[model samples]
Target: MTSQYKSPRPLLGAALYASILDSLKAWLKSDGLAWLFAFKAALAAILAVGISMRLELPQPKTAMVTVFIVMRPQTGLVLARGFYRLCGTMVGVTVAMTLIAQFGQYSDVFIALTAIWIAICTAGAARNRNSRSYGFVLAGYTAALVGVPALQDPNAAFMIASTRVAELTLGIVCAGVVSALVFPLHASDEIETTLRAQSSSFFSYIAKTLPSRKAVEDVVAMHEHLITSLVNFESLRVVAVLETHGMRSRSQRMKRLTSELMAASTRFHILLHFRNQLRLSGDHQTLDTVNRCVGAIGRLLARSPDVLDTYASATGTAQRLDRLRLRVQRHLAYVAKQDGFTPVSSLNLATASDLINRFGTELSAYVHTYASLQDERHSRENWLEALTPKTDPFVALAAGARAAAATLTLGFFWIATAWPSGSTALAQGAAICALASTATNPFRLAIQIAGGTLIGGVVGTILVFGVYPHLDGFPLLALAIAVATMPGAFIMTRPKVAGFGIGYCVFMPALAGPDNPQSYLPEAFMNDAVALVIAMVVAAAAQALVMPATSLWFRHRITARLKAEIATAYGAPLRGLRAEFENGVRDLMAQQLMLPRHEGLPIRIPMAWLNSVLEIGTAIIDFREAAADITSRAGLSHLGPAQAAIRAVLPLFKKNTGELRSVAIDALRDSMLAARLAADDATLLPSERSRYRDLLTALNRIKHALRDPQNALGQTGQPSVAAPSSR
Candidate 1:
């Protein structure tokens, strides 16, 4: 009877355990990030509050609030933000002390200096694009917080600054630890997924484009998708740098891979752009050579398994492609000597051959870097590490101006009111202006934050007075804090209400002002709450009223810049031509965020316009690089006419009509013929002839691109769609 009872109990327990484990697995698959993020955030908040209380800091809530601010879904992002926050806080506190010390006797002078400093920091924050921007935002707002508090008790400024910094540091440390120790979501994991997706998309694009030309419309669509993939890769790589040790070690190689991928894509497009020209020449030999080469590359691309598993597998495929490249070069050399060859036909064939070879080389480099990622020991030598582009000066100036205007408006309001809560309002407005300045919709975000603040205040009040009073021990208090913070943390994990969540977490602890004794003053709560709401409203209003960067205006600026860059491209030096061309167009594509596809408006530039700019710019840069090289080598004697013709045609690209461009193309063609005849001199070296031939091809392609802007732009007479417009 005892054996029978024990057996049944074990069986029943096993069944129950199996069911619970299954349910947990399903839950983790669906809602892991949200759950883990919330848990980590709550845990961090609890830790921060406990540490602050144990240390006997004046503002325990400040430390708790910081945990909420710095916490992110991924370890890399959290660490990055935390690092920047510490730096920004230090800089801000130092600035506040300096200003206070210098202008102690003159309140007006101190206030004025603080406002100016806030504006500058706000400007810097608004201008940058990544987590680095957070430093500037913190610097600006921390100054206001530090300076405004000290106005009441000037002698205690040092103590106030030191305490604030310590509290923030504790908070950052707690958030980082909790996030890392919990179900840690690493950015490197996301990066691997991105790399696989990117590689897959690239292969798909290559398969579709090679061997033959697709419709211009289809090709254009592929290019847009490719550009998006590349941009995503870049963003993921940036975060991946800080994600894991492995990622950090491979970061430079990944960058080089990105550059190679871009160069390869550019070359592939060039081949497609001129493929038709080569076929239309009706030279069966040249056409066959081109077809054979594409087929060879396509077959080699097919040999690789879809997934990049290991270095050995990728190397085998790369070796096969290398052999195919040699065969294609031989075929091109053989075909160039045929009797039916015209200068245009020969140049087209040669350039297409060169591009195919280049595409293979770059692809192999990218594949090697990608496959080697499984193990760092397999990592190879770097070839092309692209330089990061500088931010556009005009964009920086616009952002800075807007930030300054908003900050000054709030600063002036505080000075005029002289209200007791005026400092709170001033500091809040300046902080919001600095942080949210780069947001897509600054006013909307600010308003949401205000709503969050009100909600958080209520929650914080309940926890501090009602819940905490019932909890006597550290464990109970920690539990109480976690319970209070859970709702905000849950909301923070949601994408739509994230801004509201930020406001809630930041304002709750701040308004609650948890301390050892826990001061319960309803008047202070009401005053601060009103001041916070007023500050947000004023900040939102300032952003709305001050030279706001509406989508419509931004699109207009991008359109102008695209036009302006062609002129710049024409005159720019050749050393970094390819990088500048690629970087500039990609930057423009990034700015043209969300253009409606079906909407057609004559006044606005369509997404196609930017796409056209990319293609056209690529062709133009190719022409310029080839022209510059030929001129340098041949001493501008044989290639002078062609070089001059290129210069003459450059200005025609700026024209609205195609008539002048048509004339320019004729002039360019005549110059190409002259250069080709000179290139045929038997005394000239084979390398010189090769350079001349390449230059001819570049010129010829540009002429064709100019002749039919519609074809070049991949537009089929559709009216342009509206670009970014006011929502």
Candidate 2:
């Protein structure tokens, strides 16, 4: 009998194994902690800057920007968040200047506009679309920057504005400098992964395609899926800027490779459509040419440009096809089934051999035509468009106005209270607004800005009074300030965006009054506290009325999304499936948070219908795959009259494709009708023979799964009625 416990191994061997294992665990823990602290510290630093701006530094009116240059550390998301913060701040500054200047003397008017700004930001977040976010952020911060400052003595406003602009420029530069010095991110490996995944998807789809009638539809659907997943490459492109600091020479080939990959995707889509449209007597020559093109693209992905020359030349139509066929056959013979990829020969080899022998003469012309087509549309659907961006619960959780209000309030408090000599309420507002501009949550962002401003003010005072006078002159003091700035800058390179706070606090105080002997912390604290209270109050008021953004907005947008999904699901199954695949890509890019995990987080945005609709779309993909599988096995197109059946199939497949899509809608509609009838005994038909048999059955099954899909789908691995598979 086998014992449950084993005797101890040799002491040395056991010790070595345990030590290595322990070290790995320790390293992982250490790395994870570093990442976590770095993120929090960055955020904390940004908040500290807001505090500095509110303190009684000499020129406390300078606009301060804290940059957090995050390289996703994951190559795919390696974009610097620099632009987002920069744009948000600039827009806020402009809005603050305009609104304050226009409504300076009219007290209530400024409050009214502040409310409007909150409403606009909230509404901007209503949809899960990426493009819309840019607008929301722009508007939210603009209000904060402009509204809070106008509360100060009107004459001091312009000077505050000038100082604010100067501070902002300084903040932005500081952030960049810090980012460059810290751990920089890049996009090299991410682009490669995207291409590899697409290649991998093709082979996986092919495995699901064989012995299937809707083969072309499967191809089209899979093509769209990969395209969507890959487009997020746009985010990576931003990392290209990191090259200016000089070290991306190795990836110089990336630009061309990416372009080629995009071109190939478009070409593959065309070939798939052609295969679906071909007749029973479709020329084998075209098939061969298409095969060659697919192989060419795969080769490009699998090997570096340098490695490809080792392969034998592929000149002429038939020769090219042979090279492609040879490569594919090798894959089919060698690749493990779990690998989920192989060349196309195993898919249509019978059609291939016969076509080569019978239509050898036509091969060159078809190849020529295919090449021309590829050339014509190669650049249209690029990796950038495939994955550029979208919206989600992340946006819903965003609080734009709260942040703007916080910053503005802090600035306003300092000006109204008269702590910092040269600073106006408007300048403070501008600083707060700019800092809060990039925050997803207005409240949290406001806090961060307030905290940062305080920290910066403390540092500035310490340097200006505690250190400045002792220094020989302005130049020496400036030198001292610059030395203090390096560490702050280094910290800013990480994402928390807080390092800007340290720099602001250290330098802005010196800018305000050169080497002043007096310390200003006590008065600065009073002004900061007052400003915090006012900003919070203003933000709350704005959120409550005059175009409030509520979950109601989320419901409206999600409802519309649900209807669109339903409509797409009801189109011709094949083509409708294509559209659905496109929507999947949008979801993948915009809402980085994966679904089915929604319940893990507290419900932030109130779009319950969207969650429901997304489930429905997921169901439709499964249904389409299941239906196609059954239809293919039945050989619906080639029943008894084989040739005639094949001829008849084109129209039916082409025509019924449209009608079949209505099947989903009909099932939904008929189920409602059946439910009504079932309630009345007089209208009930024999349970098994009811006119609504199919529709009712489909509806009941959907109902069962909807009520408890985890159990039905068997995620827990107990007994279950499986939801239809997406093949």
Candidate 3:
């Protein structure tokens, strides 16, 4: 009664305050990191520019530009990038000085050498990924920045080089320190969280998709997420290794964990493929058996502890999963023989059973790796081996060729015209080629960057002439810098338009060329702006003219490469081959995802082809693993005829001829019959007989899979489905 009579004003105010605080916290939880990153970036730029002004360095904006370029969310990323930037800057300076010394008087020769160096660096950038690629990019552009500016005054080359290095170093230091000390994020933290989330999401995906007839879009989306997670994890591991000594020590475990995840995912895909194949063959019994194994695995994962939870729970879950895996394997073996006759269906069941068994085995290994990451015991053992990254030589060569052609064209144009702004064209062309090499959609990226550059140039020009005349001292300069950069920093937060910020950052400082006594002439601004725009235009045209990438030809090239990888998979060695194969196909999948949508091009067809390749390749790897011990114990001669037959058939699958594929299928079936006859040999040991039987079963399943004309191995021609297109 007394409480009811009390005034509600204080209570209402407190409740309102609590609600506001909660809402604000939620918003911060969602968007806080982005805002914090932007704030730190802007602040670093302001401080760098202000310090450069105080020190009276030439082009204080150079330091500001570095701040924008070096800004990353994680402290480790910032430090890693800064280290590479420092290294790249020194190398570029040396290159520029050497080039200037060799061809000081011949501008054309100097420009060509500079262009070639840029092309080489761009090629390196294309071959690399993540922050590693950033180093190559910086190396390319820094050479242009150092060399082009000093072309008019050769004597000032050292001074220009030294000043640029100093400015960039200052900016790097500022960005690294600010990013670390202010609300610092760690790559390790991100990786740990992702590892858990990915683990959970993967199991959840398997569980959810298994019981239902999921749409193709949903399946594609699910697989896309898994592939991206795998790729992202690999990149994060590299960055995490450089973050701290502890992380470096754990790098091997981390690498092992990634490998296990990939292997597990590969097995999962095998299981899914077998299930799909069974359905395609209209084998209801085998499909039912596949579903049962998948269901059992899902149930086990469903009951497991949160992978990101406390160490005790994770270890317990991992232990339980290990025990469950043995049970699952035994169950699969029992089911494999439950059905009689129907060689095709029985073979499908056997393959599915083997896939499930391997999946559980790999899943257990993955769980162990996960548990190892949470281990407190740090060992001195060096296990930091990494898988060799897969690269396409043709892709790298094409990129280099395009860059070289672009740079040479621009160099020739500059020489032919004898324009005063030739240096601008050379510098921008090299920089653009270097930067654009990494872009998935270069055509679209070029347009966005160009548009953003023009906008940024205009804005920067207005700010320099219209506002700076009335201002003085470091404070006013800092304010102006903030005003110019904050909007871009904010724009960088948006994923769709983040590239706009890059263009803005690059052009703003170039157009303004912020110096001790700022140039305020409209004519100077307009001339620089016009030169910058023209340079971008030349670069874009060069890119278009030299190996244009958006045509059907490029799509076909990607498709052909993907098909070739299947043949490569068939012949790969077992040791370290699985990881490499998975990574390669995933890389191709990523490239496939990047293809721009066109009217005639349906991504689904390539996607379906990709899925088929992955299935066939994965099955081949499984066959190798399964056959290795058996072939050795049972003697190669016992399996020789079958192996030779399968080998002969494999080449036929690589071609687009349906008749050849049919012949290959027939050959495989005959080989399977031979294998089954050998499996019944009375001289064979029981264990050998079992292995032979399993081998024969897998071969039969592969033969049955090949019977479907549409599932031909490495075949390019596929019936296209005209679904709503997606990228």
Model 1 bad stretches (over 4 Å): 1-30, 104-108, 211-213, 276-296, 299-307, 332-344, 374-386, 389-391, 464-466, 567-571, 594-613, 619-635, 711-727
Write down the lDDT that model 1 would get.
Answer: 0.69
Please say which candidate is ahead in TM-score: 1 or 2. 1
In model 1, what lDDT does residue 11 have?
Answer: 84
Candidate number with the higher TM-score (2 or 3)? 3
lDDT of 1 by residue, 573-685 (tens): 77777776666666665555422222323223434455455555665676666655553444356766767666666454344445655567678878888768756866666
Weakest lDDT window of 10 consecutive positions for candidate 2:
718-727
Q: Comparing candidate 1 with candidate 3, which one achieves the higher TM-score?
A: 3
Measured by TM-score, the strongest candidate is: 3
TM per candidate: 0.87, 0.47, 0.90
lDDT of each: 0.69, 0.39, 0.72
Give the per-residue lDDT digits (tens) of candidate 2, residues 1-727: 3476655676778899999999988975565544543443343334324333444333322322232222223322222344444565566666666777788777556655654564356445433233235445544544554345545556776665555544444444444443444553344434445534544554344333322334343433453355455445444544553543331432322333333343334333333433432322243543444455344534443443222121121124325544555555454334323243232222233222222222222322223322322232343222232322344433343434433344345444444565543233333443343333333333344454445545656665566557755877435644564454434544444446553443344234323333123344656644544443344344444333322234334333332343344345434467435333444433432332222123323222212222333333333443344334323322332212211211221221122233433443344444434332432334233431232222232233333223332211112322111111121
Residue ranges of candidate 3 with Cα displaced over 4 Å: 5-15, 211-219, 280-282, 303-311, 332-348, 376-385, 388-391, 409-413, 416-418, 598-601, 630-634, 708-727
Candidate 3 lDDT, tens digit per residue, 300-320?
666653643655566776677
What does the lDDT read for residue 395 in candidate 1?
52
